[model samples]
Target: MRETSATRRGVLAAAGGALLAGCSGLDEFGESSDEEIRSSRLPDLTDDGESQPVVVETMPIEIERTVLAERVQRTTDLLATLPMSFGADDVPNGYVRKQLIEAAEDASEYIQDARTAQSRLTAMRSLQRARSEARFAAAGWGFVEDGTTETARQSEHEAVIEDANALRSDHAYLGEDPVEAVLFHAEVEQHLAFVAENRYPSGSVNTDELLTVAEWGEHTEYARARVDDGRYLYDRFRESLPADAGSIEETLTTAGESLVDELQRRRSDLPAEPTEGDHELVWRLRYRVRDAAESSARYAGDEPGAASTVLRGAEGLADFLAYERIRDRIDDGEQFGVEEAADVHDARDQAVESVRTALDESPRAGLARPVLADAAQQIVAADEELARLRGTVRPARLDDPIRRYVTATARARSVPAACQEVLDTLTQ
Candidate 1:
C-alpha cells in the first residue's frame, strides 16, 4: 500500500495539477423549477404487457458501457502517472500517502474488472466507487502538500459551499418535503461551520481533525453521494405520488404518527439493560432508534417521506440489535449447532419469499416498486453469502460463523421494512 518515491511524485504532480485546474461550477447539477417538477415524468417501474408492476430496477442508459469505459480510462490514466514505490519520508503525510496508493491500486483493479463485468449496474457501481475513492485520496494529498497555501485552501472551501448550495436547491425543488434532502441541507450548513470556524458538528466527520481543504473536499463528495441517493429513492416512490399539497402533507402526517407508534413499540420490547454482552452496543442502538423517532416526530408532519425514512432506520437498528444479540450468545470454539443452521436457513427462505411476493404482487397489490426492488437486491446478496456458508465456516472460529449467520439474518430482517415503508407511504 506504501507509495514508491516515483509513484508519490507522480500522484502529487497529478493532484497538484488538479488543484490548479480549480473546481468545476454548479451548472452540472442542473436547476429545476416548480413547474418542471410538476410536469416531470413518473419513473418507469413497469413494462408493456406486464400484468403486474414488478420491482423494476433502475436500468442503465444505452451508452453506459462507453461512458464507463471512458471514466475507467481516465481514472487509470490518473493513477498510472504514480510511480510503483516510495519511502515514508518522501511524503509529509505517510498515512495519507499510503491511503492514496491503496485507493489508486483498488481503482486500477476495479477498472480492470469493469472491462469485462457481466452486469452494467455492477460495472457502474465499481467505477463510481473507484472514482470517489481516488478523488478522496487526491484531495488528501493536495491539501496536505506544503505548497497548498491558506488562500488556495479557502478557495476550495468556497467551491464546496457552492456545491452544497446547488445540491440543496435541487433537493428543495423536489418540493415533496424530501426528508433526507432537508437533513442533508442542515448537515452541510453544520459542516460549513466545522470547516470555516473549526467547530465540530454532531455528525461523524470532524473537520478540525483533518486539513481543512481535505475535509471540505471529502465532505462535499459525501454530500453529493447522499443527495444522489435521495434523488433515486424519491424517484422510485414518486411514480404514484399524489400531486396536491394537501394529500402529500396528510399522508406524511399519518405516516409519521404511525412510525412514532411503531418505534415506541419496538423500544418498549427491548430489555432495559443488555441481558448478555456489553451494554454500550445495546445503548447505542437504542439511542439511534430514539434519534430516528425524534427526527420522525419533528419532520413527519411536514416532510413527504420523513416517517418512512425514520421507520426504515428503526428497522435497521432492529436488525443490528438482532445480530449483536445472537453474537453475544455464541461462545468461542463452540460448534454452530444444527438449530442455529436451521434458523439461518429459515430466515433466508422467508426473506426470499417475502421479496418474491412483493415483486409479484406489486402491480396488483400497490406495493412500492422501489422498496421491493431494494429488498430483492438485499435478498440476492444474503442468498449468495448463505450459499458459501457451509464449507467455509469453522467450528473453532467464532468470527466466521458469527459473520455468516448474522449477515444473513440481518439482511433478511431488513426486507420486511420495505413493506412497512410502502404501507406508510400509501397511508391517508
Candidate 2:
C-alpha cells in the first residue's frame, strides 16, 4: 500500500522518539526498545519482501522552485545588458548578425518559459533550452571572422553562455536523476569545446608571438574570474542536490579533472621570455593582491579558513609576479635599476604584510589554521628568496631560478586545485 502523508509522519515521529530515547537513555524508563526502533524506521514489507511507498519531503521541489526563479531573474538581467542591435559594420557578416539576433530572441522565450514552469521537469527542460540558445549565440559571435574583436562584447557573450550552462546543470542535479545530471554535464562540456574550437581555430595563443603583456595579463584575469564563478555556482548547486546524489559527486570530480588538465596546458604554454611592453603584469599583480587582502578581511570572521587560503594564493601569485618583473627587466638587457628594484620590493612587502595581517587576525582554530600558518611561513621564505635575487644582474641562464621560484610557490598555486576537490565533496 502507498503511504499517505499522515502515515509517513507517524512513522517518522516514532523513529525520532526511538532515536531520542537511545541518545538520552530515556528508554530505560519507557517501553522503547531496539525492536521498536527498527519497526518504526523500516518500511512495511509484503510477503515477497517488497517495501511500500513512503512520502518524501517537498524540500527538493522547493529548492527547484527557488533556483529556477533566481535563474530566470538573472537571465532577464543579462538580456537587458545585451545590445539590441549590432550595426551592419559591427559583425560585417549579415548571416552571423541574423543568427545572433535569432539566438537572442530564442533565449528570451526560453527564459520566459522557465519563469512560468509549473513542474520541476518543465523547468529543467526550459532552462536547458535557454542554455542551448545561449550556446547558439556564442557560436554566432564566434563566426565574425573578419572584424576587429571587442573584448567587452566577446566577454559578455561568453558570460551569458557560461551562466546558462551553469544554471541548467544546477537544475538537472536538483531534479535528482543521475542520468539527467550526467547528460546535462556532457552537454555543457560539448558547448565549451565548440566555443573553444570556434574562438581559437588555430588552437591556443602562440607563446612565441609578439603579443603584449597586457593581453596575457587579461587572459590570467579572465581565467581567475571563471574559477571564482565556478566555485560559487558549484557550492550553490551542491547544496540543492539530495544527500544521496552520489552521481553528482562523480560528475563534479570528472569536471574538476578536466579543468585541471586545461589549466596545466595553459601553464605549460606560458612564454619563457617576457613580451615587449608587458608592464601590465605588475599592475595585474597589484590588483590581485589588493583583491585578496579585501577578501580575507571580508571572510575573516565567519570563514577564516577560506580567508587563509585566499591569502596563501595571493602571496604565491605575488611572488610569481615579482619573478616576472625581474625577468622582464633582464630580457630587456636593462641593469636591475635601483628604482625598479624598489618597486618590486615594495609590491612584495605589501603582499607579505597583507597575508601576515590576515593570518594574525583570522581565528586560530580548525585544521585550516595550521595549514594556513604553514603557507604563511612559505610566503615569508619566498620573500626572502626574492630579496636575495633582487640586486643581482641578469644571469646567462634564467630558467633555473624561475623554475626554483615556481617550485617554491607550488603550494600557493594549488589553492584553486584544492578548492575544486572541496567543491566536489560538497555534493557528498
List model 1 lDDT by residue over 277-342, tens digit each.
Answer: 354333333343344334433443332344434434434333434444443444333233322233
Error of 1 at 237 (Å): 10
State the C-alpha lDDT per candidate. Answer: 0.40, 0.36
True-vs-predicted CA distance for residue 296, candidate 2, Å: 50
For candidate 1, what is the lDDT?
Answer: 0.40
Q: Which residue pairs show backbone clashes in model 2? A: none
Tell me how many residue pairs clash in candidate 2: 0
Per-residue lDDT, model 1, residue 46, is 17
Each candidate structure's TM-score, on Cα atoms with residue i matched to residue i, is 0.48, 0.25
